[model samples]
Target: MNKFLAASVSPALYATKANARIFTLSSTEHNIEVGNWKIDSTQLGIIDSFFSIEQKILHGGKQEGSKIIILTSPNGLTITLSPTRGMSIMNVTGQDIRFGWDSPVKEVVNPTFINLESRNGAGWLEGFNEMMVRCGFEWAGHPGIENGEMRTLHGKAGNTPASKVEIEISEIAPYEIKIRGLIKESTFKKADLQTVAEICYIPDTYSFTIHDRLTNHSDYPRDYQIMYHSNFSKPLLEKDAQFVAPIKEISPFNDYAHKGLQDWATYLEPTKDFDEMVFNIVPFAKNDGSTLAALHNKDGSKGVTIEFNIQELPYLTLWKNTDTEKQGYVTGIEPGTNYAYATSIEREQGRIRQIESEQTVHFKIKYSALMNKEAVDKAKKAVADIQGAQKTTFVHTPIAKE
Candidate 1:
């Protein structure tokens, strides 16, 4: 028998608006396995008689005034999606563990316009520090002018609010809850991009899945780029936290990163004037054709694992920002269509991907927050296999082709 299963602790009780019973399982080390549902509001209209899964709309604070759609499962998985802000995953919690990070700003709302001045500018940095932010359609890095037009930091996708947002709760196998959302991103005379995001959760299970499909509804050939800027903070990213991944090669993105190549996996405490380090990773594919990476807490008691379809997102970027105690201390586990480099440079390197006129493409990423020792060991072993199979080498230069 699995040690985690054998050591099943008592079940905790949680209340919901409908007064439902949710049994949450945990271990001796305060490692919660499942979560209970507790929410009651009139904003959540009933779609069906299936009360096991709840879907509701939460109006943000009066300051931001953003509207959010929240989906809660019988288990302890909760997902918050902001339709007004391009349907980004604002916050995700599994058994009370924060799977994403929080910005210095209290209210998370989309900016009016994209700031295309510098890398860590004011406006872009506001939305850039969320849970899972989509980074591109045209560019995915520092602000620069390409083709004599100003390009914003990351891209405009994060600021482009979704027009039409839909939600549905259904069933899938043993999982009674399947939430599907469709968000539309289009410009008047420029481009149109549509995303159908799905989240599936099973009762008593500690993991969930996210699947996204982005379609191009334009007539002319369009250049597209997307990066899942998955940020993590706090308990999951302790001072001595470790990052593990099945990396085939590591390319430094800056001088600071090149200098810290020897100790890239280990995180440090937040300092006053610490420099940021960035690395472009070429992940090794497994027999299942998927690649994975994880961030484990100091004691290895808990961690967050990210799995992506290597066929679609062939590259990954690791952003280590232990810069300041106030505005820093978060890491990014990003999987994207291309490396997070300047659009001009990536295009010159033939890394920019183009879609045919009126064509579509799909991308998927899965986030799992594990609590048991067994799960952590398995993750470590998977990363170890990749390290053992290949010799990991680092490039000590700026982020570009020599």
Candidate 2:
């Protein structure tokens, strides 16, 4: 019943991409006041190579500062892994963020490597951005889980495919775009990232795969990982930063926090005082532990709600790098598929769900950028209004998931 303005009244006025569904967006209407910080895309406008992505605005090219980039879809599939907090969405006064396999979207470092390292000028990664960037997250690189009977395990990354993706810019709601990518069970390495692949006939499901080659070629097992390494602007986060999640328990980052491993959802500024930022295995305080993730800020402006559903993934990671100086100034609320492998431990012990090799997973994540008390009230009212329209299983309040 959350009255998420999924469809905007704003009209689309751009070129379309063949057969696609366009959604609405009021994102372009805001008047922004960008600061002295000018964002120049290295891959595009900036004279210097900015190690960014090739971007083409779908609408409203007349905004002020280029800090946010908002994306929408019918199904809940937008950002992944280290998703942007107030970041992305070409906002006027939200936050700055980065993206990609190994590097960040805002050019925190060069666009080379994922989980691995490539030293050099790319080390420009030092400084404020480094402290704010998400790092050291991991995941299975191919579709489904890999099981082992004796020695060898799941198939290599190249077992699935990449051709399943289908992108379309809308003709009707041309402002919103649609991307319908799938995994027809072909190649694995092609789908490195955990992108939800379309499965025809099924109600709600996502298939993902991976494909990577370990260059050293040591006669051994190859461990793989792929998560969108996101880093956010720390200065913008209030002053006294803290994280919140809905989880009952959390694996503290090297056992760091207020006292011991309390509920994983709430975070306090580590006593060791990391140079940058990191909220270890955080979650939302009230979400029934059904989801994972949390949002922290300085001076405590209420708090943002970030959740990771079990459909697309299961694990959530929190990396705290607070010992360095200078750029080491931020923290991360990392989300993942296997909770540092501890989730698996719980599952095997019958505390959580377990998956056999080659099993498909599916879940939906709902992101509501609730502003102070105002936004929370709006959402509550929305849930109330839903009962007025169509009969819901529950009443007005957010019912706990059974």
Candidate number of the best TM-score:
1
lDDT of 2 by residue, 212-259 (tens): 111212232223332223333343233345444343334333323333
TM-score (all chains, Cα) for each model? 0.80, 0.43
lDDT of 1 at 66: 53
TM-score of 1: 0.80
Summed over model 2, clashes come to: 59
- Residue 285 shift from truth in candidate 2, angstroms: 11
lDDT of each: 0.67, 0.29
| lDDT of model 2 at position 74 | 16
Evaluate model 2: give its TM-score. Answer: 0.43
lDDT of 1 by residue, 210-272 (tens): 777667777876777888888888778878899999888888887668888888999897766
